[model samples]
Target: MADNVIELHPTSRSDLLARLRDELPPAWRGPRIGPDIPGWTDPPGGHIHDLVLTGLPEPLLTELAWMAHWQQVIDGSPASVQPLNQFAIAYRRACDAGHELATSIQQIDWETGESLLNWYYTTRWKRFPPANTRFRLRAVFHVPRLALIAHCHQGHWWELDEWHPRCDPRIPIGPREPHGGRIIPAHITQPWLREAVKWHLGTQLEAGTLRWSTIGQARQLTRFDRWITVAFDDPCDVLSDPLAAPAQAAEFRRWAADPVNRAMRSCDRRHRAHRVHPRQVNDDLRAVAELFAFVAANTRKARAVLGASPWSAVTALHADAWRRQITPIRHQPMLNADHYVDDHALAQITAALPLLALPRGQHMLVTRGDGTTVTAEGFGDPQVMRMILLQILTGRRASEVRLCEFDCLTPVPASTDDSEGKSLTRFRYAQSKIDIAPDTILVDDEVVAIIEDQRRWVRDRFPTTTTNYLFTARKSNLTATKPYAAGSYTRLLNKFSDLLAIRDSKGRPVTLGHTHRFRHTKLTRLAELGLPIKVLQRYAGHATPSMSMHYVAQREEHAEQAFIATAKFKADGTRIRFSRDDHDAMHLFDRADRILPHGWCMLPPLQSCDKGNACLTCSLFATDATHRDVLQHQLDDTTALIDRTTTEFASRHRRPMPDDNVWLAQRRAEQQALTRLLDTLPTEPGQAIQGHGCPTAVTEPVPLLPDPTFPRRTRP
Candidate 1:
């Protein structure tokens, strides 16, 4: 008998047995042991108890009793006797082999528990330990006393294997399930580094500097820890005196830049180079710099635990210099032409949306590219289809669409000045990325209807749920408290694309993996409609106009090319031909203010227009074939107004009004100008009314006023 082992007295054993008999059900009370003992079972139920504690070792019996008591209390039901049977078999094997036995659950560390599981599986079951072994150990470690002993409180931080962010009031709820809220600390191999990283992360959380869903930051630090281990003989020594390890730091730069050193994924084998993306390297370096800066700021307190500060002697200048030493990687620009979904693909996807409405756990029959039929799981939830439709209609980010609150739509108040009399709705969404962006945007009736339909579905599906989200996750979420995960939605969308065989204009398979493409496509369409950049910025919910400009800039370039390619007509129906120099000097596409509803104002960049809405009649205005419909509409509207005014005046005065009536004359002049513009435009579609045969040519170039100093060129 070891000193750590507790010897239960006969009276104590009798009390335990009596309590077990009282608490356990009849099926778990019958005696059955030896070769008849079964392996691990789910819902662990049967007719007989495989093992009894009547004649077991006192230490093993005491451990089993403690587990049984806690299990019953936690479950609020009669506890299973499976753990006793499993451990008893291991104990008997240890006795047969003359191996040391654990006195209690507290004495069983991870290695000792693993060996016990291995013996139980290999000898009795004749197989290797299954995945459930860790789960069983997790159950054992969750015992009240064991958990208290393992976890430590370190001033606003808990040092534990896992952290549940949802349980903490300081962390905001993210668009993920409660289980996804866990932040595991086991990935950081170095204990000291792990502690420091935990402290840094805790400080960020406390100060509200970290986004609740940002797990990549922690993963980036893990890469740094791995590099430190590989790059130095004693990582702790190097961390303690970072400035002194110049050579090691240089080596790290080389190691991080090498593609061979990068982690390999299953798909990477298809590529010949297997090169790590520069963006990943940049993220790793940036994370390391941030961690070092944080450690340097709190030298005294951090040093107490880490033995010495990681980068106390390093200054901001030193960190900046180190960052500059790495090769700069330019950000890959996202071009709208390359990323936006074309009309062909968008139409196909919209038509196939109904196919995604399969019920949960049911598979749909799909034809593969090889013509073989196979059953595959669809999105299952109709809300996912509605969510996709909302993304296309509203052009919102996937997070904003997926994490919408149950009551996100509200009717816009009718305004006295609204002449259109169209019903409007305002949609509110979470602006997760930009803090300064407004959450509400004006949406159309169609968008409102989609949202309302989703709301109805949520109500019918989860009648008892109290969650605020419109879209709820189905897995491991009995209460429907978790919003749909972004990753899961993306995976399902990819599957949908494959099942429907969605193809692009080029006949290649179109992947809807990047949901942001919908946003880009919407912004690009708005830009093509000649919406101002400032308005596009607000519509996009961007913090700055620059991001909106990125999408508009590409569309503007195409517009400019179209403008230059077609023939341009002045107010007097004179066709103007642009020499290369004339086109550069006019900067026709550069100024947003000069972009007219029906044409371009060919005014120089330096000039300003004082007459508003008079571009249609200005000599500087240039109209092409594309504006033929708009020019004809303006002419028709002007003629109708003039005739109506004349008739009303004649009726009031009992005679017809004269032609020179001041307002009437101006209206006549505008009407005449629009008629002439419409006549100059090509009647045939895709026809260029250039220098060939239609109107008198002003072939030389339009002259501009000279200036002593050059004016600033406006961006397109």
Candidate 2:
């Protein structure tokens, strides 16, 4: 034999045949019942040729091809002893698993092929370890059936009618029972009703019509199902029966409304109780109504058995059923800024994140607790820290932040060289909540670096995995290429928070226990900066203007802060009395600081200054009617300087100075700046700057050059 060519040794081939013969029963070896077939040949030299799969229908042929491909994969992997004997051994294993092997190959159908494939998986491949392992095999079986396509991934099979190409493979198959049997109450004991509920949810999940992130749907319906069973003293099937649905729904309303009865708490992740919040009542009722709709759309037998159409039961309830119930539905209150991370706190966290990327076992002070605090030894993996940073920096929800893909981060078309000052980077991500196309978010250089680091980490650790996710866990239980699932990411965040004992600004232990709160914090912070409602909508990926409005709500405190840039203070730390006029003037001083030559700045204090300080010609500059005199004076000065410089140059150079002449150009730039500034001065009466401001207040917030013990007060 050639040195490079791999051939099965005679001794190993004999041993492989012996092992194959031992795994199969005598019935497979005895061919007395039918005509001869390739797979049915004796185990001593039993072989399956590629020709055995010929002359079959397309579906069967493809299935057989997949089986053949899998066989080659397994045989080539490190687990197989004799590589040349792989096909025969797989054939024997298939027969051992009870796939009926007709003696004639021509008689085999797609059903027979499917049965053989399933049997082979159950008997051998599922439990087969790569004992001799050269390389791992990742064969995804796309088995097509009459109604839907069956997806076989990592040895498990799931029926998926529709699949998103960009979906995270880490997402586990939807439970045959919705929410892993948690949302459905156990008391509703009718088997078919339970099955009907499962069918609707599962079908929706498989069809991509329902989202796993929307946990409320299953919980609400499950609560309704339990309530109907208890209140009506009837089987679950009664809900499907149109005549019984109105009464069933009415009884549920009574049960849901009764103050004495315990409110049903959601069994999903949040576990929110139906008590107190009117929103829960509305959601639960709406959920039940939606369940009825699903039943109407899908289940014909259940519809027939229920006597009325599926929607009959849902429509029977009064349109104001939520208000009529014991608990009246009310508008859900918008979120406030309290949930957001304070600027100081965000700075502290950002500073700490870089240290997290250090090699493991490096020591650092994690938290300062009164009794016991976690030390540097308690930090989580660098990947988890990166995830937290992404959340803080981008204000993305946990799902968007965690499932980031490698190639999606890019520079905005208008942006160039991120290393340059003020350049921006943008990331495109698949929006998890809505079915809209990928959305773009602006991020800074730091966030862009984090993303790059994560991509390198994934590539280095899981080199063989085909996953394109930027951040991937090295050890995944599902497949070689599984990205971190939503649950896993959440758990990691919680674990990191608990171990480090990270705290909030109030000196209380602040856990990023609720990740969605980060999204709230981000949008609220942006809104606090007085970003346009439309801009905020795009930044937060909100579906509508109203949704964006919910996050941008202004509080009285925010208004107060905007007006009073700083409070009067004394060096002795004693209270200083100030007049209302003084307080009102301070507000005017704050507005005057950002007054430009074109438009007024309505932005809040916490936001970054987007203006590059070229205030002379920026379109965002604004000057009111009161500034017209000052602007005209500046323009006159500029014109005088231009003429003086031109005349001086003409005398000295003894020739016409070119347009590119440096001194002449400076004079022209000054002229243009003042000219543009003058044009924007308004003629109409409007609010104007009050109090004679010092140079510091009129320009940017430049630090005073000379150090002084106390801050110098600006002369008004």
Candidate 3:
């Protein structure tokens, strides 16, 4: 192994100088010059000689000059040369003694990279932690030439511990921008297993199944990998052997379920027992299953790449057993009342929206953990308040609200005014989760105004930006290409809540960390307003009605109260008054069979309705003002049918059919029943017709047949 390891020698001064002179433009290689020099171009301005005179080692000097040149060209700013020179001096001495130093970043092997980085961090860049070292190394590796060489030679980016979005195109730039994209093979503790996992992840990336957003979830497989390393003397053997699967699977399940092996410990100060959340265990098992399944599916490819098809012998039974063992932790119910933001919290949050703004010459008082007060401009970007407002009004997902295009609003034509008096506008946003959902919805003037305000702010702030998004990221986004991060808005909202000390009705401090609650609140409010389910489905932008139904929480008591509040009437237009005892006995709201599309069944729950379409003419049938439109439509259709049938009969037999015909009689009876119901029921919903005398109990069951001569009195 020692013989195979490649040794790198530092570049000599003459060689390094020659390379730098050849690589850089002619204008850049001349005598030392400052920005004050006349006719000095920004990048090619003569500063290479000054860098050479810094007394730094040849390799470090050349790298720094190249970085300075690249920074001036890329970011229109020169690299900070003084601090890097001071650090490079120390680095040169360490290299001279053969201490913690690599000849070049490209030559640093993955196994020894961490120790070198730690040494640099602790001895030199102690002010910045390893996590934040990227900022410190910005001038060092941001150079395209160095980064490309490191990638091409070392088979990885210059940063061995993490991969940035620029490292791979598949890695998303937006989600974890500015910071590095994902932890790499160096993060794995076991060397033998690291390469295998790396290969597996690469395969998944090539297959287009793995996403950078979900990479954190995919990392859960490392726990299983670590367990395998401990369980088997030679973990590599288990990958190829068929019989090792069942035992491995069983042992992994036990290990993952154990509280001692839990990934995260309890942080509570009360010393609560650290229990492994079922979700964590399930995520681990799922990752393992996915890995094995992928290998099994692509056996030849897996063998060629990984040198072994891990879990190739895993059968359906083994998979089933693993799946069955997964702890069934039900997520918070979709219709959970607490999921929606109540009126108290919502009112407080809305009232505090103005405080989110950082007005010129004004400061917000912020109290730190130590009880000391300091003034801050405001929470975060003031645009977040408008984003929150949009969510509360539109019930859109956070992503949809945050990633809205600059031209998301289109003025609705005045001719299409269904909003009565208010102006309606069609608001458009990306429906990322559902591919088939409509991107545009009709919003009121208030929603339109909010979007318009955001548009104006964006235009004023980024006048020269070419990006089309309404909300652009404020940090590390020079070109304004990236969308406003969802996490940024969430943090801003939380800060706003804390600053204002917003509280709910119960006096507990309101934390709007989950902005989706605004969406839930909006949907729940719409549902409460008695909007038709299909219409609500469209408004929510759900692909299916069932998905929309999940947001509506109709409790049994509310349903019963609504049922009792609605005025009921029999087929002959006589009102059916229900006493308290009669309401209890009928169980009208509890029985599913009693509920109908256009009306309710007045018959007892024990009896089945034999009359199918005869509901309109049945004596026991009852309906209210809500079904008036349906009844009227039915009556008009029946009248049209009667006219068409009479004309057809006269044409076929050369004479009109007898008036006493059963079909004609039934049609006439239905028409009369519908007309009487529509006329008797008030047009306004929940309005009941006044009875002449004391209310009667609806205890007697009536026949299903129509009774034309029935008296116009309340049923008893």
Candidate 4:
């Protein structure tokens, strides 16, 4: 009975190394597990370590412990950290339950294994184990009814659960999810080629050269693999026959263009289903070509004949043919103003946010069309609502808002001009997709308060744990504490919309898609208000102004309106005459007469003049009382020349700027001359025009508008 009740204990480093070395194959076994095998080295000699190795089989447990490192050297890799941790949890539980190590390894079920993995993740570690480092397991869970599992390992926790059967050899189930979710090679008819491709992809995944996110590459390569299997009766003949490469590439082109093959079809996320798109066709062709290139370069037989890979040439030829044959697919632009939420719909969504965010027990009423109201409890947890609010206020992507940490919100220091002691609060968070560093946005006090409340909530809920995330879910019976899944807000937003009976201006039910529209709505509104392109670029986290423009609608109209408003043009259908006193008008110059009807010069005080008398095109040219008479006479002469040139060109039917017509060039030049003269000339007799409209010979330059759209910086 005492022997059956195995008191688990940590093994010494020397003893553990001896056991692991013994488990290694005959070729690998030595005085020490050293460099010949990839990861094994001198085990860190420590008396106080985390993992307790008692009641485990000598070979299997030893192998599992060194699995992460040895994966690189082995042909058939052992479990990665995620699945290894999961298997360890299950194996430990059986051993603790008085089952022998051998029986425990075989008895663990998927359901039980998965449950323990979630518990380890949410309750003990709160995140997955770190990669590329050796793991030292900590305390095992041995509480009654709850199975024993390894909780902490390495510096982080061993908690990320995976369904990879190959990770645990003791499991009887066949491997369903392959390494990195790659399509199984068994599906391909060519046995040897199938194995080769599988090994290549698996090695890439283990080496960290390829990621699970990029598993789509494996799917793409599989298309080519299937093609190879059919094209050559013997697929191995690809290495022997050099001609197979070009023949296969040509066949692929035909296959791609054939509508019958359905190679051109792909899933369109916009429609939420599969649809035909040419870009996807192009991607598929490129994927196959790249796979061929990779195989040719790496494979010994193919490389011996082909000096270098010929797939580049093959891909180029196919690309040209594809361009000629396929009608160009008109892609939906990344930024479409049509997708922008209407103001009325946005307003309703904004108004309902506060009510929806109200914590449980707080009552709110939704007014219906017939004037009857529905009493409703809070829409969701306060943190969920706070996340939505963050998206709206900061115009951040929904994912960015959801993944924010506890200290993401910080108060901006008071500005130099902020004598009233009021300062905007800054929201800072990570953008995982783009690898963008902490993006910071300054928001008003209302947003600041919401952030504070959310931070307090997360802190209160996770008082003891190091989970500083602003939003978190405790582990339930089956699920892990998911970092808010992408698009988590979409369903809740729709629910809130339904609850409020919200409708757009057209009387259509308003529907939100993935909360991205909030970003578009905010940016579109800013664009509509005529924010500068540079400012929009910064706000959108875009690399270029062109990328930012996708969010803006009616830019030309907005620009024209902004021009009229900011220039403060006179009403009554007449251009306002400038006086020397009106220096504010002179500062609006965006490089001279290309913009303003009356040209302006916004150059610094000490700048030297380059253009002597060419005031029309020169940005620095300013109108004055002294130049009025001279400008007026020039305008009269230029108008006469332009009229004569137009009459001559129309009567003769010559080109507008024919070789024989010096008058046309003269007329264009004089046309600018006339504008220059008119701008300097006063509309009213009493007013004197300086550059553009400098009244009273320019006294002092008015301060330019300090754009509020810019993220205002303040001292820390």
lDDT for each residue of candidate 4 in 1-716, tens digit (9 for 90 to 100): 56775454666645654755565575343222233543333221111222333445655455444443344233122213335544565466645656454433223444454555554555456865443211322211111101112111111111212212223222122111112121334444554545445545555555555544445555555566666666777655544544444555556656654454544235423343344366656666665554545554555643432335432233233333323433356767665556566656666666566776687688877664233577878865566677777777778887677666657767665563256666767777655444343377667777888877876776665554455355654221011123444444566767776677766555666565457767877898777655789988877887777777777655332333233234322343333345422433444543343323333444544565675445554424444344556667767777886778677776888545364466466456656645744643444332323333222122212222323344433435
lDDT of 1 by residue, 19-45 (tens): 545554443343433223232132322
lDDT of 2: 0.50
After superposition, the stretches of candidate 1 with alpha carbons farther than 4 Å from their true spots are 1-118, 121-155, 166-182, 240-247, 264-274, 308-318, 326-336, 360-379, 416-422, 507-509, 553-716
| Positional deviation of residue 115's Cα in model 2 after best superposition, in angstroms | 26
Output the better candidate (1/3) by TM-score. 3
**Highest-scoring model, TM-score:** 3
Deviation in angstroms for 124 in model 2? 24
Model 4 quality (TM-score):
0.49
Better of 2 and 4 by TM-score: 2
What TM-score against the true fold does each predicted structure earn?
0.62, 0.52, 0.63, 0.49
lDDT of candidates 1 onward, in order: 0.62, 0.50, 0.60, 0.50
Residue 379, candidate 4: how far off, in angstroms? 5.4
CA error at residue 613 for candidate 4, angstroms: 52
Model 2 agreement with the true structure over 1-716: per-residue lDDT tens digits? 36975553334433533443444343322222112433323332233332233233333333333333323222111111132123234455655656455532224444454455445555665754353321211122221121112222221122222232222233334321111112332333544444455556655656777655565565555666666566655453554455555555566665655433434443432433334355555666666665555665544545643444323444333323332443454565765555666554554566556455656677676534333534565344687788887887677777676666668677666546455566687787656675552378878777888888877876666565455566654342212233565666667567655555555545665566687666777787677666788888888887786887675545443443344334444455433354423333344446665544432443454555665654443332333454567667776877887777777878999976789988667666656666544443342233332111211122122111122244556545
Q: Rank the candidate models, highest TM-score first.
A: 3, 1, 2, 4
Off by more than 4 A, model 2: 1-189, 202-209, 228-233, 236-247, 250-276, 294-328, 332-335, 351-363, 369-376, 413-420, 436-438, 464-466, 477-480, 507-509, 553-558, 565-716
Task: Put down candidate 3 lDDT per residue, 1-716, tens digits, no spaces.
Answer: 57986666666646655775577554443323234333333332223323322444455455555555544444333444443443455566567657856445445433344444556666766753445444445435443334434333324232234455543444333332232334556556665456545666765655556655456533676666667668878775555544555666667877877765544334532333467677878888777666555555666655655463334454444444555556678776666665656656676667656657666467766543333555756554678888888888899888888887888888888988884777888988767565578888998878988888888887776676566678777654445556786667778777666666655545556577787767767787787667898889999999888888777664432333344454445565674454422442344747767666666666666777788867775645556566667777888899999999999999999988998999998888787766666666654344422210101212121122223354568557
RMSD (CA, Å), candidate 4 to true, equals: 20.5
Error of 4 at 308 (Å): 18
